[model samples]
Target chain A: MVIQDLKVLICDDSMFARKKMNMTISALGINEVFEAADGEEAVAKYKENKPDVVFMDIIMPRITGIEALKQIIEFDPDAKVVMASSVGTQGHLKEALRAGAADFLQKPISDEDTRAILENAAKGVL
Target chain B: MFAQFFGGYLLHKKLVTSEDLTQAFEDKKHTRMRLGVLAINAGLMTADQVEHVNITQQSVDKRFGDLAVELGYVTEEQVDKLLSQQPTEYLLLGQTLVNNGVLSNAQFEQAINDYKTDNELTDSDLEGSKNESLNKLVTEFYHLEEASNARMLTDYVTMMFKNIIRFIDGDFTPLEAIVIREFDAETLIEQRITGTYDAVTCITAEKDVYFEFAKRFAGENFGDITGFENETVGEFLNVVNGLFAVNQSNEGGAELTMTPQQFIQDKKISFEKPAFCIPVVFSFGEVDFIVSTE
Candidate 1:
């Protein structure tokens, strides 16, 4: 299965950041894109849709990225999740990966990084 | 933009640690190089003079050009000439790029000329000297249709961010603002008069993170600032208001305007005023907020 054909979830509380993720994902040639306002939203969407990969943001309301990632992990240990955050979120990022984040993409998210993370994560599933 | 631009400058000079620079730069990275900083760094004026000018600008509705001219630092002719161009603070840009051979004077001049001609901005169009990130954040966050309202919102947020970022030492880390839906307008006004603004505003956030930001911001600056939450909430209201105003403008003006103000308590607090006051809950503890009126 091609990575571009897979479903992806972009979770961030920031409208700007969320839109950017949506745009970047769309620009990356991905068709089925999902979005959530925060960690709780991410979890609800994840449970509902179970996208191929989840792009989670650290430092969100209701659920921090790490906690959300852990919750997602608990649901599916093999869930391919990528953590998105600004610089200086090292411990959280580390904890996220430990909690089963497949990869981490630092903000401001760029085209190459999104492509690589999604493609790489997709390799594990599809 | 100001964050990146200013961060690069501070980092290049080793004036601030990479961490602090990053922290400050992140919140306001795109804030346009302040004219005062630009002038001072360019060796055109002293730091003290810049500080005084900034204070004066804040106190009055004076433009940089007006202030600079009033202070005799620059003549009306000099400012008028510079105003004719695009972000063309020659002394600052020239000095910044001169020592570094990234672009020559002629090339810079050509780029400026091209930038102006291609954009079709005449001398009359004075681009705001605000931090681009704050401007961008407000506009993008709201996604408003009213350009003027959006610009006002951007300016309001830019001012609020400038003051609030100081609380957490400048953290732009995003957070969710869980604004609670319950508030009795009369009780809120009564509390406002009695100096329970923080607690009153607290009832609105209700969420964990909103409480954290409120506690942290209020704990530090509450006593120092009377009518604290009313002012703080006003700032938050401005964010939400701007967002609402801008978004509603697209649908031919939704007629959403705020009537809440610093009440002196009692006397009905004007029952005729707009009843619905939204608690614009902020989820981030890092990004503190300040009061704004505009």
Candidate 2:
């Protein structure tokens, strides 16, 4: 698929974070973008939209990004969920990967990092 | 990191007013680091000798480095070494103050020496942003050594300053920290850290100052948008706390996680234990960071 045609879902509790990432993703030519304020909403949106790529935050008001990732993966084993969180500690990293996260991104994630992930997703590498 | 602490030290000593610092931080971007200030900072030349060179330059058309060398104040090798080094932000602030006539050359020399001596910072420590040096600087600046959880406080504060410089502005003067059991906050974003240890951290400031800080971090004009300030500042706290948790987990094997941020306005929040209320002054206004190790 073309990179611009891919649908992206961003799950972060902070409105500022969500807005920032949404703008960046939209600027990258991805028109269909979804946002979730918490992990529960993230899972709901993932199942509803079945976006091509998902960017998730670790900590949230409801179930965390990891829990949401597990739910999405269970619903669709081929889900490409990227754990984009501020806390990429060893424990979280291991847990996210063990739970079937496709990739991990540390927060304050730059536009370049997001672009690379989207490109990889478009190429079916992630 | 050193630059912020140095600015703090200058403020503490009353060498310059907060207004002076605000102006200097704004002007420092345009201020070039001169060889005289560099040599004086390096202890290679006396202020009097630098002054002599400055006076001689009025008549003799020569570069400061060349003039200093010609006057036998600094050798060519020393001048080269000083010139080769990158001017640190703190030094540039100092240079700007000097250029603005806010501080004299002799006063700058004394303040620099006293600051280095008081903080026990060596030349190497001042040059680069080494973690050890920064931890030491933070510990000393905040008197964290006297606290029971000195190591954790040092690590957290050091990380906070680094992130403040990263996400926010570096042009802030960290004021002294006050211990308080409770605070009536005008606007505050509070988040809790749990797992190996439990602690509460908060960022609070006045209304306009809070908005300005959010604007700086978000880089957006969310004019009169209710709750936008909370979200923006909450995200900043979350990022800093998340990074701190990750650092602790990686370095000390201490598993830590942060709760979702809580936004409080015109409310009285009390801590179980005494919290360190660290106030930092920006060009816009003052903001307070409160941390409670519970």
Candidate 3:
């Protein structure tokens, strides 16, 4: 359950934001990170890698985070998928948590949040 | 962005009182303006650096320093000295509000973290809340009409610069005293901008439109809140343009083409070209902003 040698998957539409998140997680030494452009790709990558942790943005083109979350969970009942969303996505957070996302990270992704989510992701696996 | 927009909505629905709404507005007003002052006070930029950029950006696509060089205001050496003085503390939304007593420092800090947790926002997501009507107008016009993804990127720029400038020269004004002005800057935007935009144009008595659209767009066409804001700023700019050009005759209409949005966070970064940009100052009730360019 521990993310030692953990593989991370980042799913979002913004290349700039995805780069920022990758850099932060990489700085934390969470190497072996994978990337997906939207919900469908995220679920596909999740299936391909079955990464220990996933950071999914709820509102992506094609399939949404919620739909993908459900799909990922269905594929792997223990899939650890966290969400990357804006603060305005408050209402959806409850639904995400209910839908089985491990945790959520806010936008303008920060070091503190990366640590928080990763830490929690470990807890979710255990 | 989340607080002001939601506070206004809650008030409108009578979920919260006018007092709560006013208090939040006052806090935002102080915070947004103070970030600029703090950036200046910290020597992030000299008065000349800011003023020179402001004056030049009014007419050029280039950023503050590019024009500073063109105008001989400061040398590259001086720019280096000033860049080191970035007001990291001041640029923080919570610190600005708390430091000014709009909210106690502790309270402001708590609210910000809570806001972050409550909203699950990334910084880029929060950046969308910082734009005004003009940017919104551009968002709609550029994204919808032109159908370019490039136009959608302005949210980050608007958020980062939302506090970059304020109407320091103006004092508090009421609804009766409020005035709206229009100008012709077609020569600078570099693109042939004709027609109207509307959206981010309405300041919502403060910067409360963030939540209004957040609520509206979250469940509809956009993804989640972050995705919603990511897309909204561009649309908002177009909406603002629509409202702004509501009455302009074609003969008197000003073409307002938008250049690609560039974010100059903390320090001054210059655009590479000259652009026809509009400078608009607005005061909604007692709040004020000096939007020189979108």
Best by TM-score: 2
Model 2 lDDT, residue B127, Cα: 88
The regions of model 3 sitting more than 4 angstroms off are: A1-4, A123-126, B1-294
Q: Rank the candidates by lDDT, best first.
A: 2, 1, 3
- The residue-level lDDT of candidate 1 at B217 comes to 43
- Please provide, for model 1 over B1-294, each residue's C-alpha lDDT reduced to its tens digit, 9 standing for 90 to 100: 232223333333444344543334343324344455445433455556656776788889988768987998877776655445445332333334423444343443444344334334332331334455345544443342243334543544454345444432343322212222333332222211111011121123323444345444433334344344444433333334333333333334333322323323212323321122322223242222222222
| Deviation of model 2 at B229, angstroms | 0.9
Q: Docking category for candidate 3?
A: incorrect
User: What DockQ would you assign to candidate 3?
Assistant: 0.01
Task: Give candidate 2's error at residue A80 in angstroms.
Answer: 1.4
Question: Which stretch of 10 consecutive residues in model 3 chain B shows the poorest summed lDDT?
Answer: B184-193
Local lDDT at B90 for model 2: 87
**Two-way lDDT contest, 2 vs 3, winner:** 2
Candidate 1 lDDT (Cα, whole model)? 0.49
Residue A42's C-alpha lDDT in candidate 3? 90
Could you tell me which residue pairs clash in candidate 2?
A: none
**Candidate 1 ranges beyond 4 A from true positions:** B1-294
Identify the leading candidate in terms of lDDT: 2
Query: How many clashes (backbone atoms < 3 Å, residues ≥3 apart in a chain or on different chains) does model 2 have?
Result: 0
The candidate that achieves the highest DockQ relative to the unseen native structure: 2
Kindly list the per-residue Cα lDDT of model 3 for residues A1-126, writing each as its tens digit.
555477899987655456657877888777789999888899889989988888877545688778899999999988888876643233456688889987776554567887777777767642
